[model samples]
Target: MISSTTMGLLVLLALSIPVGIVLFLLGFGIDAFFSPFPLIRGLGNLVWSTSNNATLIAIPFFVLLGEVLVRSGVAARTYAALDRWVSWLPGGLVHANVATATMFSATSGSSVATAATVATVAMPQAERLGYDPKLFSGAIAAGGTLGIMIPPSINLIVYGFLTQSSIPKLFLAGLLPGLGLALGFMVIVAIICLLRPDLGGERRMFPFVQMMRALLALVPIILLFTVIIGSIYKGWATPTEAASVGVFGALLIGAVFGTMNLSVLHESLLGTIKITSMIMLVVIGASFLNFTLASANLGGALEGLLDSMNLTPFGLILVVVGIYIVLGFFIETLSLMVVTIPIIVPLVVAQGYDPIWFGILMIVLIEMALITPPVGLNLYVVQGARKTGRMGDVMLGVIPFVLVMLGMVALLIAFPQIALYLPETID
Candidate 1:
C-alpha cells in the first residue's frame, strides 16, 4: 500500500493533476485494492461531514479579510511603515522585506498571499536600489511563512479543526514562535550582511520624526489583529465567530481610511471566493483520503512501523521533521497538513507529545515548505513578482532562512515552552 500510494502520488502530481484531485484519486485506488468493507460507499457521507464543518467556515472569512486588507491599501501602508522602522538595520530594506511580511502575516493568514503582497511591493525596490536579489527576495519568501504562524492564521484554524484542538489556544501557541521567527530572520540577515556588506543596500536611519509619522500607517492592521485575536482569546468569540468579527473590523478600517468602495468589495469578494474554493478542494480531498486510509487501517500500519523502529520521543520528532522537509519539496503545504494530520497526529500523541506544541512545530516545518524548491509556493510568488531575475536566484536566496528554520525546529525541540507558554498563561 505504501509503495503503491507513494508512486501514485508522485506520478499524478508530476503529471500536473491538481493536488486535491490526486488525493481523491488515491483514496479511490486504496478503497479498490485494500479496504474490505467497501469504503467507497461512505464517500458521500465523508464529503458532507467535512464540508459542513463550522470550523471550515473560518477559511473563507479569513481569506476575505486578507483580500479586503490588500484591496483597501492597508497592507501597502503597513509595508511602507515597517520599512521606515527596520530599513536602518544592517540589511537595509531586506529587513523591511521580512518586517513587511511579518506585519502582513498578522492581517493575511495565507502565506502565498503574504509573500505575493510583499514581493509585489519589495521586488521592484530591490532592482531600483541594487540590493542582492538572492537574499532580498529570499527574505520576502521566507518571512511570508509567518502568515501561518501568527494569530488569526488560516493554517492554525485548519489544524485545530482537524485535530479537535482549541483554535484560540493554537493561536496563542503560535504567537511567540511566529514573532521569534520574524526576529530570527532579521538577525540572520544582519549577520550575513555584516559579513558580506555588498549583499545589503544602504542602511540609513530615518529621522525619528519621520519614523513617528510612518508609525500611523501600521495602526490599522494592528487594530484589526487585536479585534480578531482578542475576541477569540478573551472568550468573547469562537474562532469561526471571530473570523466574521475580523471581516467587520477590516471593512471598518478600510472605510475609515477611505480605501473601501464598491469596486474594492467586488474584488475582495471575488478573490476570497477563488482562494477559499481552492483551499476547500484540497482540504476535502485530504479528508476523503484520510477516511479511506483509516478504513483500510493504514494509520495503524504507520503507527506500528514507528513502534518497530523503537525510536525515542526526540527521535520521532526528528524523523517527522525530516519527512516534512522532503515531502515539502513536492507537496503543497495545506494538502500536506490535511492528509498527514489525521495519520501522524495520532501516533505522536500516543507517544505523549502535546498536540498544540506539535502544531506549532509542524507550522515551522510548513514554513520551510513554502520556501523550499520545486513546490515552494512562496518561491514562486516572489519569482512571479520579479521581471528579470533567474528563478534560481530566489531559490538560492532562501537557503540561509531554511537553515534558520531548521534551527527553530531544534529550539522547539530543546525548549517546547516557546509554543506552550502563551497558551498556558492566557487561559
Candidate 2:
C-alpha cells in the first residue's frame, strides 16, 4: 500500500498536475488499493472538518495582512528603510531583502505573501542595479521563509492546533532560531560578495541623520507585530484571534500611511481571495488524503518501522529529519506538516525530546522545502515575479539559502536550546 501510494504520488507529480488535484487522486488511490474500509466515504467529512476550522482561518487573515501591506505601499517603504540600514554591506540590496523580510516576517504569516511583497518591491531594484539575479532573488525567497519562523506565524499556529501544544510557546521557541538564520543569511551574502565582488552591487552607506529618519518608517510594522504577538502572549486573544488583530493592525497602518483607498482595498480583497482559495484547495485535499492514509493503517506501518529499528533517541531524530528532507522536496509545506506531525511528533516526544524544540526543528526543514525545486512554493512565487528569468534561476538562487537552512537544522540538533531557551524562561 505504501509503495502504491509512493508510485501514485510520483506519477501524478511528474505529469505536472495541480498539487491539490494530485492529493485527491492519491487519496482515491489509497482508498481503492490500500484500505479495507471505504475511506473515500470520509472525503466529504474531511473536507468540511478541514475548511470549517477556525485555526485554518488564520491562513486567509495572515494572507490578507500581507496583501494590505503590499497594496498600501508599506512593503516598498519597509524595503527602502531596510536598504538605508543594510545596503552598506557587501551584498548591498540583498541584505536589504533579508532585513526587510525579517521585519515583515514579524508581522506576516505566509512565506508566499512575504516573497510576493518583497519580490514586487525588490525585484525592480535588482534589475536596475544589475546585481546577480541568482543571489538577489534567492535571498528574497529564503528571507521570505522567515514568515513561518517568526512570531504571528500561521504555520506555527497550525502546528500548535494540530499537535495540541501551546501556540505561544511555539512562537517563543521560533524567535532566536529565526533571527539567527536571518543573520546567517546576511553573513553568507557578505562572504560570497567579498569573494566575488561583481556578484553584488555597490555598498552605499547612508548618513547618520538619514538613517535615523528612515527608522521612523519601521514604527508601523513594529506596532503591528506587538499587537498581534502581544495579544497572543497576553491572553487577550487565541492564536487564531491574533490573526484578526493582525489584519486590523495592518489596515490601520495602511490608513495612517494614507495608502488606503477604494482601489487598493479592492485589489487587496481580490488578491486575498485568489491566494486563499488556492491554499485552501490544497489544504482541504491534503486533509482528505490524511484521513485515507490513517484509515489504511499507514500510521501503524510507520510505528512498526520505528519500533523495528530499535535505535537510540538521537538516531531516531536523525531518521525523522532525514524523512522530512526527502518528503519536503515532493510535498507542499502545509500538507507535509499535516501528514507527518500526527505520525512523527508522537514518536519523537515519546523518546523524551521536547515537542517545542522538534517543532522548531521541523520548521527549519519546512523553510528549506519552501525553496526546493519542482515543488517549492517560494521558488515558484519568486519566479512568477521575474517575468523573464527561467525557473532554474530561482532554483539556483535558493541553493545557498538551502545550505544555510541545513546548517540551522544542524545547530538545532546540537543545541536544542536554540529553540528552547526562550520558551523555558518565558512565564
Best by TM-score: 1
- Number of backbone clashes in candidate 2: 0
Stretches of candidate 2 exceeding 4 Å from the true structure: none
Model 1, poorest ten-residue lDDT window?
A: 1-10
| Candidate with the greatest lDDT versus the true structure | 1
lDDT of 2 by residue, 1-427 (tens): 6667777887887888977898898888888888889887767777888889777787788888888988999988988988999999898999999999999898877788888889888998999999999999999999999999998787898788778888889998999999999999999999999998899988889999999999899999988888887887777887778888888888888888888989999998899899888778877777788788888888788888889999899999999999889988887898788767877898899999989999999999999989987689998888888888788888888888899999999999999999999888766
TM-score of each: 0.98, 0.94
TM-score of 2: 0.94
On residues 29-63, what C-alpha lDDT tens digit does candidate 1 reach at each position? 99999999788888888889999988899899999
Clashing pairs in 2: none
Error of 2 at 147 (Å): 1.2
